[model samples]
Target: MKEVPASGAFRQLEPGPIVLVTTSYRGKPNIMTMGFHMMIQHAPPLIGCVIGPWDHSYSALRATGECVIAIPTIDLAETVVDIGNCSGDTVDKFERFGLTQQPAGSVAAPLIKECLANIECRVVDVVEHHSLFILEAERLWIDNDHREWRTLHHRGDGVFAADGNVLDLCDRMVKWRHFPR
Candidate 1:
């Protein structure tokens, strides 16, 4: 389907696993939430995150060249917004949000204690396209312990609809305008 660029589209951003970003600056640690992330490959897994330069967490994620993205659940909606809304540079998001930290397997960034899953990533690439920052993360450690986990996929605006009700698809076709968003 052809994409129509709409401003302020209140898209129900699919609720994804809210990943906590832990970064260390000058021996100090910081953690942030990221929903705009994905895994590109399985073998020698490649991860991707869009880290905008203007964001508080952006510089940390880039400058440190290291960070941890811990996946949270729907129950963490409040914490997700708390970490995602506030700047990590000035505020201790972890402490302010009452999050506990755990040692990471491969990097300096710490993992959030209550997260459902954790991904330890090392920066491998950065891309700039039309005022957006895209960083490629090399997944070194991945832990998915939560038995019943749901993914958060962006649906637009601040709305993130949790992924539920599994579906299987075969061959398919539909008119763009008629297709469900």
Candidate 2:
């Protein structure tokens, strides 16, 4: 491990899978690709994610305090990257990508029909200094019929990794069994 720039530390510590966050404001719905997000709590199903002022979805989230986190599978790798490459301010991502939009139960933000799972969330807190939004899951929708289950992970730059073979260690999770599934 040779000396590398400290700025590149995030590449090694990237958290969780890349997801699409949707927000609707003034009857216009928008989707943004998010790679910086993590689970913060379990009881209330809280999630912390970075959606800075630079992002088009930021204003909508700030005003509405709601959004949907859609987890896409490996098959959408190219589409996911393409979504992030453009700005929602100029483009209607849902129509541009031909992605089906399904109405969410708890939030005005629509869910991507192609994704593996969609979590409707409401902002519970905002850490303005860090551009962090703490969201509480209001509802969850999963596609049990969708065959693709592998999710994508961003490794900084243009690199990404997809979920691979499962290492079933359920028997070894004695201490974590009490945690919710």
Candidate 3:
């Protein structure tokens, strides 16, 4: 085995999926690519995401206290990268990318129709020092027709992976059937 540099090694620890976060504030809707989000809990569905203070959508999210987390399939990989490269502060990403906006049931943030799944989240708490926002999923919309919808997972730099393999360990593990969904 070979050794690698320790700089920015945190990215290797947990390279999570890249999701498009949509924020709508004062009649303006914006979309931003986010890779620093994770599921914090199952019951009442909690998600923890990191959004820098300087991000354009951060102000809207912090002010409105809501946003939509859209999971995009591999087909939109290029568009996702493009969206991430640019800033919503200067560009109208939704119009530029031709993404359809669908109104969410619970949150003010509009959902991206092109994505595989859209999760409506309301800010539950925020850790100011860490730029960590804890959100509770108020609504979840998934494209059930596409069972094989592959999504991109950012592996630092410009590299991304289409989640392809499925390894089930249900049989070997104890099933918690009583858990609330």
lDDT of model 1 at residue 146? 62
Candidate structures ordered by lDDT, highest first: 2, 3, 1
In model 1, what lDDT does residue 118 have? 70
Model 1, which residues run further than 4 Å from truth?
1-16, 129-148, 167-181
Off by over 4 Å in 2: 1-3
TM-score (C-alpha, index-matched) for candidate 1: 0.73
Best by lDDT: 2
Per-candidate local distance difference test: 0.67, 0.93, 0.89
Alpha carbon RMSD to native, model 2: 1.2
Candidate number achieving the greatest TM-score relative to the actual structure: 2
User: On residues 1-181, what C-alpha lDDT tens digit does candidate 3 reach at each position?
Assistant: 6788887676775567799999998888999999998899988899999999988889989999999999999889899999988888899899999999999998878998889999999999999999999999988999888655888889877789888887886665567756653
Return whichever of 2 and 3 wins on lDDT.
2
lDDT of 1 by residue, 34-105 (tens): 666666665465776776676776777667878877777777767777777778768887789888888887
Q: Compute each candidate's TM-score over C-alphas.
A: 0.73, 0.95, 0.92
Residue 4, candidate 3: alpha-carbon lDDT: 84
Clashes of each: 15, 0, 0
Select the stronger candidate by TM-score from 2 and 3: 2
